[model samples]
Target: MQETVRVALDAMGGDNAPGELVKGAVDAVNAKENIQVILVGKEDAIKAELSKHTYPKDRIEIRSASEVITTEEAPVTAIRRKKDSSIVVAQTMVKKGEADAFVSAGSTGAILVGGQLVVGRIRGVERPPLATLIPTTKGVSLLVDSGANVDARASHMVQFAKMGSIYMEHVIGIKKPRVAIVNVGVEEEKGSALVKETFPLLKECSDIHFTGSIEAREIPHGGADVIVAEGFSGNVILKLYEGLGSALIGEIKKGMMSTFRSKMGALLVKPALKETLKTFDATEYGGAPMLGLNGLVVKTHGNASAKEVKNTIFQCVTFKEQKINEKIKACFIKKEENE
Candidate 1:
């Protein structure tokens, strides 16, 4: 039998807290036999929501957390003050090994701050970066440091490339994933000071399949399997990618409904169109995993629906079953020995 992957879910963290979050936990437990969900939040609210669903009683449990951290609060301050907050409690579970992973659709700052301060980072990991899979024409690309370290150094980025390559090759099953730095142009010298400094390091790095620089325009075309960038640049690329995708989809839907002739055409193409569009849906990929953490900590969109939440939980299971952390540890250990 497969080992159970226990996930500590922050039930009071997102916009649809206790409702969609609870439903997601129920859906996850019902869908997989090797999964168990420990809902962390206000007991009364969580229980009320869980009561609406039918699930394996043994697969779901609730851990009461009296507080909820908000986006406006300073992450460090909130984490320190809100000792009983859902985010803090869930992360603690991971730190204590009570849960295999922690999942939250809460404040990004709180999650990032608490992940480091609470769950801690793997040794030899200079900095833990948020890594997420973004949809691409070739399938999906891993974007490292998506929003964690806004101000980073060349060494941090080089490590990002290595970790990103490892995740893509293992979890995503992409062999020898191509690694590239986000740049202003394809030329090696065309980039900011940081990129110029980091470029040569990645090129000389033997661990990853370095493919030189990749421009932002080439991203959607699946230019590289692993796109490495500092937190600031990666976050900008991700937000713009999400916004543009939404706008284009909206325009297409509007155009389809504008006229009777187009509406009839839509009926003929709806199935195929939907399948193609599903490939680009960010929710289908799940939450961003904060790579290099001692224990897994995933941060999903604050507005995530039940479907996205369920998918994120599944993503955590894959991360565990693949022994991603162990592989990452081995890579770092080898690097340390060489040094």
Candidate 2:
């Protein structure tokens, strides 16, 4: 019998609240046979949304969470005070081994705090980084520490590279994922003290194929498979990437609808344009996974729609099936043995 993957989703966490969250959960369970979703939030709200969809009763379960964590509240304070918050309750399920994974489109701070305090970290894993798959010219590349560990050290970046390489190779099916540090220039000497120190360490590692450096401009062009950086710079790159993609898409639509000549061209190329744009859609890849945690914790965008939520729930299945945590533990264990 296939082991069922139970995903506890924070139905009240995102902007759309129970509606999108519940729909996503329902869609995920209906789409996959060996998956189950335990929606965590107010009972009435979730049930009201669930009522809209006809799904298998056994696959979808609801666990009431009286409180909801907001973005304005201090993450640590909220987690400590709101014990019954949907985010906390869902994460607690992961810690208690009741659920295989926790998916939330909540406050990033709250999720990070709950992930560390509640779900905890894998033994020997010093820092868990937020790993997001960014669409590139040649498919996708994994960007590590995009939003977590802002003050990460050189050693932490090395671990990020190691863990990232493991993920891309195992889950992403890249034979030898090329790992690189996000740097100002392609030259080895042109980076912050942290990057300069971490460069040689990555090169010394026989496990990953560490390419020297990747400039921000080269990122969208598929420069490397695993782009490693401390959270501050990584977050900047991510925000700019998202903002630029959105602006370009908006401009493209505006141009296509401007004049009769352009409108005719648009009608002729709408199908092909949509197909190309779908490749750049961030939602298609699902949420970012906080790697190195004992149990999986995925953090999606707060404004995520049902499609993003649904994809994120399914992403958890692949993470569990790949045995990513086991592989990460072995990577650290082997490193310890060598030293």
Candidate 3:
């Protein structure tokens, strides 16, 4: 198989590291013939995990990293003190251009911190935001800064919209994706000072299909293709979305089992409902990418299965092939000059 993309997988990262993490890396390599994976972590521990599988030897290799970064540790301190940790080592591989991308399921804060501080942002990028693809009624919407840039400004919101548009258009193949700033309401005067200022900025930008403001309640209906917001609001909205989905599923399951009649009906409709709900599961979307950086960094759930891990790895291929970073820089630079 011709290797087109080489990814650095943090074998020591994630709750299931060296086990699920190692298995995920091997599974990704097995599924994608053109992709190669370099596992970074304790060699012996990684070997123990790999021993359970009979993967092609050429497709996977383990790099040594004695220390492991814990999710409890502070992002800055962990990155600095745990130089030999798998997460740190993986970033090193990406920084040195030895790998095309890096994937971690351990500490999201560390990944975001390392991505900007270590991998750094592209020239002209003010602040990099973590972007995630959320499944919606109309299909999927890209949420910009879902977990980064908590203190972003209106200018930053405008930049997020533009950068997100480029990603959705070029990488996600959503031509002319409607970009909207997540606000308290659709009305121009309905938000904190930030939303009010960002509304006109996004509307004035001719490059993106600015759709004005999007309310959190309308997010599940896929109100916009690219939803832009400061990390604070975005994070709250996303967490609620995930929580609501879980709570709904639980209620439906319990309600169906309350009586024989409902149980039978549920049995008949279980397959369809399960399939439908599966699409909304956050884990199904894999990790979120930290955009505006010089290189790609994806953050997956700590309990991510091999399937989710594989998706996160494949996501990098599109980011690289589509030249998302280059296009994002161009979009902002061009938009900036117009202002």
TM-score of each: 0.97, 0.97, 0.95
Deviation from native of the Cα of residue 43 in model 3, angstroms? 1.1
Error of 3 at 218 (Å): 1.1
For residue 127, give model 3's deviation from the true position in Å.
Answer: 1.2
lDDT of 2 by residue, 1-339 (tens): 877999999999878898998989888988999999999999999999998999999999999999999999999999999999999999999999999999999899999999999999988788899999999989999999897999899899999999999889988889899999999898878988888898999899898899899999989999999999899999998999899999999999999999999999999999998999988888888999999998999999889999999999888998899999999999898888888
Best by lDDT: 1
Please list the Cα RMSD from the true structure of every candidate, rounded to 1 decimal place: 1.2, 1.2, 1.7
Can you list the residue pairs that collide in candidate 3?
A: none
Clashes of each: 0, 0, 0
Q: Can you write out model 3's per-residue Cα lDDT over 1-339, one digit (the tens) per residue?
A: 344788899887787777888888888878877787899989999898899997889978888999988889999998888888888888988988888899998888888888877788877788888888898987789999796889899888877887888888987798899888888777777998878877888888888899888888888899999999898988987788888888988998999999999989999998898888887877777788888877788888888888888888888878887888778878767756976
Q: What TM-score would you give candidate 3 relative to the actual structure? A: 0.95
lDDT of each residue in 62-86, candidate 1, tens digit only:
9999999999999999999999999
lDDT score, candidate 1, position 197: 96
Q: How close is candidate 2 to the true structure, as a TM-score?
A: 0.97
